[model samples]
Target: MTLSCFDLGERMLSVAEAQRHLAGLVGEPLAIEACPLAELSGRVLAEAVHSPIDVPQNTNAAMDGIALAWPQPVAALALVGRVLAGGRFDRPLAAGEAVTITTGAPLPKGADTVIMQEQLAFPGAGQVQVSRPETVRRGQHVRRAGEDVARGSLALAAGTRLGAAQLGLLASLGLTGARVHRRPRVAIFSSGDEVTAPGAPLSAAGIYDANRYSLRGLLQALGCRVIDLGILPDDRETIIGALRQAAQDADMVITSGGVSVGQADWIKAALAEVGELGFWRIAMRPGRPLACGWLGEGRTPFFGLPGNPVAVMVTFLQFVQPVLRRLMGQPEWQPRRLTALAAEPLASRVGRVDYLRGTYHSDREGRLWVRPTGRQGSGILTSMVLADCLIEVDADRQGVAEGEPVTLQLLNDFS
Candidate 1:
């Protein structure tokens, strides 16, 4: 696999370079805390969890039926008693004797099998008849001990993100708390005086600020505690002061509409005055002028996204989101990708990776196909709204042909 050199100062870098550097920024995860099971969703496990007991705990009936020995000594069996779930038979099964059992009821001692109720006939006089003796199989409809999970086995490994299924599994283990990393506090803001907030009266030359809102949603989806520092003007001193304070208050800081070459010079100067700039550009479309910077004496990480709405999202997905997952202590989290047949030819160029907004669906024959959203412009927010996935064209390849295999990254990997 090709890797980008992150140390190339001022030189446009590749997406991999930024990813590798940001991923390595946090040497260790944040402090571990034992959160209540109900509040464990979206938190990353700090250590592996083990099952204290066998999942089933006992050999029980998996179906409502008659529990008897594998082989019957006679044609008919005497129905001694009945057992429901959580209840057990008081005596062992005798030769030619059977007990009615409900699902999950523990089998009587000496009984090694169960015949589902549908396969049996009640001949009355306290007897259950097995008309087809050959149909009864040994151990059928029985949940053996430790069938689901063995005692003292690893149930979930460290770095596992707790979601619905994970929480349910922990609940099954009778755990009320889980050791997980604390949520990272991220400070976010938008720059540029020309950018106006939504719901506010806009000047003729001003555009609505979509980056801050969109970034907040993205960060929250990954379980981050966002600190909205509001908007910053084109002043250098104000930018530097705000960044310094944000660095001290938050684990990470992010801004949009600044750090581009020849423009946002105040942001560049502020970055230099406050701390360091890793790089200001990348060899990618939509967000070529992505900035990797650090602020203050603590060297808190910073990400300067593009001014355009679409570029902000593209850069965040490609560069920012990975770091967020890492900072949140999810070492096992990786961007989800899938391959689909391109329904139409996608134009791309070499030397820079292309991410085309596209909607994907499976055909009746189970073939997955993708078609790009109309008008692939950096300022087109509608393109992103209408697209469910991003069609990724490798930097080494020029384009994707119709019906050819195309790689795609989903917009939402987890809810």
Candidate 2:
């Protein structure tokens, strides 16, 4: 069946419906590449990684203490030898014998329990004394072999984004590199004669283009390779030509404006002329006119964002971000969300999800509360700067009263 991306007759899609529709069209992940451990952070794994050997490699001491066989009814033990990290005891312990063991040192053979150093004393040369025999616990202060990660077991699964912890695990496994999906190459552009690039003289009524810069940063944060196509004029031929060129080299294409269903919506018309249009409008605040489809031969994904600066940010965060993740080989990833008590009444209308820019804070008592950033006008770019999160009001909610709980979609992946 053919999917229509620019059909003016289709009803406006809801936020969730739009997301689900885009998810299916994103297709398979990009090609795989081997990234070194140092370059792996924020990259998605392409295949499940298995540990070559057991973590810790053997039963080891977790604390600096004396290790001995426990519950054997021993009155005392003679200290046979000492072992530090990276050192091993030469011989096994006989009955009623102990070894001084440091943290991370492999346990001497036949030793099953560890007593804290403070709980033991040297009463005589080569003799150890347990001051608190009753306090000694069996099998204490020992990390068993494969306790953390078993040998030949899965360590990191495919589609997992590597972070500090994951990198540390790979390092612990003595690996220098692993297979990861290549970062998606996204071609971004803005349309409108009034949209002027920075460092260029601003014409009368011209505004500096902020969407391109912001889009670059957001795309980079998601580990995408951004290809800036610069600002295109309102001419249909030029827009269509740039999109066709982008599809040749880019995995996806995004435009900042000219998507709404109006006579001036040139990009929407261009998209329909050169490619398919999945949906052009969504039932949401700030950014209602969002178009998603493919350019040229359905190889390069396209996103037509709202023209308003704030709407560009809102729609990108709520919609485009997830699409990028899917294209980057991430599996069903989602941004951060939490419920907070509304610090004040929130403006909303029934039958539409309101993505109000909000700042959430914790009170002295550690309770989280949220409130809208003043004046959520789509053109006010500063509101997004001052805000840390998007306060999401459900379509069923008419409005919010003070102290009512509301869901917040955090702007940052928040680590």
- TM-scores for every predicted model: 0.95, 0.95
Which candidate number maximizes lDDT? 2
Candidate 1: 10-residue stretch with minimal lDDT: 1-10
Per-residue CA lDDT of model 1 for 155-232, tens digit only, reads: 998888889988988988899989999999999999988888889999999988999999998889889999998888
Count clashing residue pairs per candidate: 0, 4
Per-residue C-alpha lDDT of model 2 across residues 1-415, encoded as one tens digit per residue:
1374345456877788777777777778888999999999899999999999999798999899898888655666788899999999988888888899999999988888878888888878988878867777789889999999999999999989988899999999999999999998999999988999999999999999999998998888888898898999989899989988998989889999888766766987787777777665678898998878878875578888988989998899887888778777775888878999999999998888999999999999999999988999999988899899999999889999999999999886723
lDDT of each: 0.85, 0.86
lDDT of 1: 0.85
Model 1 earns a TM-score of: 0.95
Tell me how far the alpha carbon of residue 335 in candidate 2 is from the true structure, in angstroms, after superposition.
Answer: 2.5
Which residues of candidate 1, in runs, are more than 4 Å off? 1-7
